[model samples]
Target: MSRMNPVLSFISHNRYWFVIIIGGLLVGVIDDNSFLTRAQYALQIKNLKEQISMYNSQYGRDEQKLNELRRNPKAITKIARENYMMKAEDEDIFVLSDDETNNNKENETTE
Candidate 1:
């Protein structure tokens, strides 16, 4: 009778365990749909949640500004003057160029 090599005998004895472990690893880490791959989806969900929070905060701020504008004529006039270059009939509006604004910012920073 031939004696089996010790390494071969050990491998044969544990073959099922090896297959189960390797198969589990393949399904968990190497498959297209896997727990490891789901980590990316989790990160995407986190980013989307952060964006939703940011948008909600921005919406709240915009809603508050809208309510203020609705209630206050002065706020409406301020927004119009800042955004639309609007002025009263008796007032003169001086529009500053972008270069002038940048230079003013530089001067302020230097000071």
Candidate 2:
């Protein structure tokens, strides 16, 4: 029999390993639904779950505040006064800012 070339013999010996490496690359990185794509989808799912949990916790806190507002007249009044700046007709609200206070002090000094 004729002697086989060294390159052909080496390729024939490692043919199965070449197929396995090619198959692994296709399944792991080159396929449409690949492992790399699945890992990215998993990360997006994790972030969406975290956002859902945060919104749920915020909803719970808002619900507690609503319940408190509904049950207690003082709490309702406090929310109205602090958020809406509402006051009774008999009460005179003095709204002062730091800038106004500084201007008043400057005017006093000039006088």
Worst 10 residues of 1 by lDDT: 100-109
Candidate 1 lDDT, 52-84, residue by residue in tens? 999999999999999999899999899989899
The C-alpha TM-scores of every prediction are 0.71, 0.71
Provide the overall lDDT of each model, using Cα atoms, as 2-decimal numbers: 0.90, 0.90
- The runs of at least 3 residues in candidate 2 whose Cα sits more than 4 Å from the true structure, single-residue gaps closed, are 1-9, 99-111
Please give the lDDT score for candidate 1: 0.90
Clashes of 1: 0
**Every candidate's CA RMSD:** 7.4, 6.4
User: Which regions of candidate 1 are displaced past 4 Å?
Assistant: 1-11, 97-111
Model 1 RMSD in angstroms: 7.4
Q: List the residue pairs that clash in candidate 1.
A: none
